[model samples]
Target: MSENYYELLKVSPRATVAEIVTAYHAARNAFSPDSIAVYSLFSAEDAQTELKKLEEAYFTLSNIDRRREYDRRLQQGTVPSAPASAPATAPSAPLAPVVRLVPTPAAPAAAPSPQPLPSTQPFPAPAFFPQPPYSVTPTAFPAAPSTPPMPPEGVTGAWMAQARERQGMTIEDVAQLTKIPARTIAAIETENLSTLPARVYLQGFLRNLARQYHMDATATIQTYLARIDSLKKGAA
Candidate 1:
């Protein structure tokens, strides 16, 4: 009987060029000198013969024109004549055994098969995990604010800073919300009066800042303005 290239490569007849290539590589590696497989079943000379068959199968099937012609010959059940220069070999040469490939429309033939160690040694047991101490119990602390509450003296720059921290609003965040420059907001937070904008602009900025903190805007504006005035007079 003529050789079946698909059977030799262990790839499906419908396999794509890539799958055929993968099967060819797998069959090659599976029979190499370093491979643990095939040593007992086949001699080195037999292995060489099998490799020749494998190369022949792969080359014939890999070519578009040759594959088409081979398929036509295959379907017609005719053995195509070998090249005139090619020396004839016995048709009864021993074939290499390989892992039978599952057909396509499923996982491809390139999937790795796991092989266990040749030795019979047992695996070590996993170590035990330490138990948590039962004497200590987890405790919950009251949710106190990280920053202290505003001073009783009223709307100092420190108070605005504390409120902003409590509100999780950075100076950049306040500037974004109020359309104020971030440096101005920093100046307001640090009580840097020389850098403070005109009172009209600062008043609008304070009202916007107060709205962000969800506080009474008018009270915040009046108290903060009064505090800054008192500080300025004290400085002079």
Candidate 2:
């Protein structure tokens, strides 16, 4: 029930960046407007407020310098408090009593007798003229066969992009399906490893993307790690 960012995300103070990211996603989904789990429990405004808090927590704790500063603040017992609000269970004043008005009774009127209604005779159907029979002919057009998506050709970002395209998936589509950010997905597809998270988190992203596209997750992860190693060696 603590309002601390770590508590809000259900993570420990020493949680890794990958853990923080995972917790952030879980928290976001739990409070999402479209989430059925919280549909009845929280109003749209409340959900949005909680989502904002989750984002703030993630943004702070996911950054190395910010997280270190926050930890220092926590250790010094100087963490900022949330804004104050009205008491939860304040009692309201009782309503004033209402007075009812009485009315005088009126005299009843005599009932009138009902009259019978006139009945109309039904009309007979007319004889139909001769008509031609209509029939629907079934056309037998052959169904076009669907081709399976091709496997990735190599362990490079280009192959990853090609595989994604072959599966007819856009970066946004993959992001939505995988719950990974579109920017992260773009970085992966473009081989911009420097812009991505640590190796563990990057591997997780690759695995999730590969699973979504029906590719071999193990192979994709191994290839991506190998590529990263080569890049590091070249830079060194």
Candidate 3:
């Protein structure tokens, strides 16, 4: 949590370098090959700029002397000094406080009332009310349990292996064709869909996988959607 490095990484001053690295990697990995519009927003030049900043921050913090100085300043709770050539402005004078006054009023005389004599009858104690005994029974309200999700038909690791072998396609080949990572494709084939990113990205990945396998992409997406719905229902 160094201010100089945090500023370089465009993160909060209290953020750790690990957090900075995580944010950087998240930005880098978010660029999907099939997303022309998203990729277009960050050109090679833009990427280089961000990479340069990240590298600079890492380099500075990784150095012993620089990091020691930064730590010293952080411990001292001081804002690091600027260059000697920086301009200085004159301090403004403090303003005087305004005063207000109000006219004084005369005090009023006290009024007195006659005290009442004590009564002979004793004060009555508060009466307690008693009720007849009644039976109190507890009621139970149980929630219905959620059902387990069903596995997809004709979709398994063995099935994927057979399909890939039949088509003469390797994991790498599928990745290159679809622009999805091999590990992600492996996760999909293994039906560990939660290992993937958000639902929208998963949908796109599934669509790409279907397209690469020459399967009906629409039907494939529908199947994935149904599986997700079932999973949610079961979890509920």
List all candidate RMSDs to the true structure.
31.7, 24.3, 27.8
Backbone clashes in model 1, listed as residue pairs: none
Q: Could you give the candidate ranking by TM-score, starting with the highest?
A: 2, 1, 3
- lDDT for each of the candidates? 0.62, 0.62, 0.48
Judged by whole-model lDDT over C-alpha atoms, candidate 2 comes out at 0.62
Q: 1-236 in candidate 3: lDDT tens per residue?
A: 11244555556645543454455455445533443544667666555545554544444443334455555554454433221111233223322331222532422232133222222222222121122111111111122122112235724444554445434457776676567888887877766646756778878987766644445666666776666667668877
Off by over 4 Å in 1: 1-151
Q: TM-score of each candidate?
A: 0.36, 0.40, 0.32
Error of 2 at 92 (Å): 7.5
**lDDT, residue 28, model 1:** 89
lDDT of 2 by residue, 1-236 (tens): 12567877889877766577678888888989889988987788878877867766765675565577667666655554442112133123322332222532431232133222223222221121121121111111122122223335446777777766654457775676678998888888788857877888999998887765557788788978788778779878
Model 1 agreement with the true structure over 1-236: per-residue lDDT tens digits? 22367877888888766566668778988777667797887777667666766767766665555577667655554533322112344334333332435755643555454322223222231121122111100111122222234355667677788777654456775565557898988888888999999899999888877655546677777888888999899999
